[model samples]
Target chain A: MAPTPLAVSIAATIASLVLLFGVLELVRRRRLREKYALLWILTAVVLLILSVWRGAVSGIATALGVSYGPTVLFAVGALFILVVLLHYSTVISALTDRTVVLAQKVASLEQRIDELERGQDSES
Target chain B: MAKRCLAIIPAFNEAGAVGDVIRAIQRERPDVDVAVIDDGSRDATAKVAREAGAIVLQLPFNLGIGGAVQTGYKYAWDNGYDIAIQVDADGQHPPSEMSKVIDPVASGEADMVIGTRFREEGGFKSSAVRRIGIAMFAWLVSTIIREKVTDTTSGFRAVNRKGIALFESDYPQDYPEVETQALAHKHGLRLMEVPVQMEERQAGESSIKLWGSFYYVVKVTLALVIGLFRKPIPLPEEGGH
Candidate 1:
């Protein structure tokens, strides 16, 4: 396996570190719920491990007959992105449906309250 | 006790047409209580419906046709309505023909009755393209539900308490008319079609434009097929949310 450039490896490791810390900061600040941050944290940790142990990717790439090591990383990275996006799609669908139900209930209750208030006013 | 009937008129920006639609229902069925679901219209839909002697449930914003209609169902379910008929606010569903749809449900003949424009002729038959689309959708929904549904996309429907409970708890969100029959059938609710004369919409355009017909087909097909796999929700508790 051709050795990855020292500068490139160092930059990747740093970028991965930044991502891990960034997600952690968001979690600490309560900006991201743990349920959602769990996937992000897992992603950052995997990215860091791959960047630091550069040989792991190139070694697998050579076995798979892939010409370049980074190409394999990008391919796997794209698949990871697709899976995350699909998860997001499901979350959004469920949330919107729940929102619709909530809106319906709230509207109904508000009308009921208005009628009750009008009844009280007329009774007095 | 007499069955409590509710005429649910779901309206968007059809202020010009909604008032007359309400009056027509009052004229045809004085015993049935009318409730108009005002789906966040920019005009005076809520005011017009209320002034026309109907209770108006005004949504805070537009919820599309499905959401609006489901809101009406929820209201029917919550208030212990024994029968609910969904008529469009645009006047396409003539309230004059109200009994043709309502009678089946009231008499315990069917859990739900869809008022079809395709049968018994003489009224708006829809455009050439819409007729083809209506046919295809009927085939798809009929095959899936194992029921012969002629006008699968007709929004004009009447539902008994059973059907109302089924939908208020679990209703399709988009292009709901086609999927609702399948949903009701799967839950063991009986569906029947009655021929009724419909009029050209009194105001505003249909939600589905001609250009979006292709997308409508694909989306509705997906919703119908995907729906069959979902587990049926437990029946809603009597007289509760």
Candidate 2:
């Protein structure tokens, strides 16, 4: 028996929804952050479309002389790493600024204590 | 009413020895008015100080030694007292020798007088841990301030108008002794020390345990050393009276 068009469409839709939910779960568990989550969700939706219409993607990859599987995997991996590194750098900058503020506070406190000591000694 | 000296005693749950300390100071120098700063005491320290005829200034919260003493300085400054003495409520510092520390200030010879235990035959006798801590702190103070301070952590001290004004304005809240010494030097105040013997605490155990003492010394030493490089703090508007 041949696969019907309605059955193929339903399977494609289900596969797309499952991939979207899986990506969102990764985000919720912090295995992925917001930026990476958006990218992953988009990739998964595109992959679902390609899985349904493999002929178009294969045609494009063949014209570009690249293996479709390896190319897509590399694109996703690179994007994830770049986004995470950018996030880490932002965090480090914030921590450095906080450390500078704390050092200033400590210095100010020391000076105030010094002034008080002088005042006391002179009074004596 | 005659102008009398106000002795500020910073007490923290010193119930066992606070009464005796108050009575002893009163006996030694009855002319001086005493105010015990009860720093959120959990025990009957407030009652004991009051029973011993000391005016109790109950802090709303615990402010440690620095905050408690600063409150006393503020009280003395506001009340028009001629002098303020920062004496421990613990019996470690003998009330009998309070006069020796106070007389110099009374005679106008020194602006601040610190009771130096090292000057006497028997110096401080805490645990070996505390002794090493004190010595290291003393070294740090001496190096930064260019004065050979024998006692860097002695609590028995007296302050006149200038000293009171200084403390009232901006006193330190942690590891005060060494920081106070460096501050005194920076302000160009006449700092002097007198020979006095300090006894062990009569009632409670020392708040600084062995490991705590080590941390205290290291922390204060680093603070004082860092303070040496920093610019001096500007005097407050109502300071140096």
**Chain A fold similarity by TM-score, each prediction:** 0.89, 0.46
**Model 2 misplacement above 4 A:** A1-124, B1-3, B236-241
In angstroms, give how far residue A107 of model 1 lies from its true place: 13
Query: For residues A1-124, could you state the per-residue lDDT of candidate 2 as single tens digits?
Result: 1222455445655767797778766644445544345545665666566546645444555666665433543454456557657867996896687677668767988999999999999999
Best by lDDT: 1
TM-score of each: 0.71, 0.63
Predicted complex 2: DockQ: 0.02
After aligning candidate 1 to the native by TM-score, how far in Å is the CA of A120 from where it should be? 5.6
Residue B39 shift from truth in candidate 2, angstroms: 0.5
Instruction: For candidate 2, list the clashing residue pairs, or say none.
Output: A119-B162, A120-B163, A123-B161, A123-B162, A123-B163, A124-B110, A124-B111
Q: How would you encode candidate 1's per-residue C-alpha lDDT over B188-241 as one tens digit per residue?
A: 998999999988877998889878777677667755665665567788788566
Query: Candidate 1 chain B — worst ten consecutive residues by lDDT sum?
Result: B222-231
Those runs of model 1 whose alpha carbons end farther than 4 Å from true positions after fitting are: A1-124
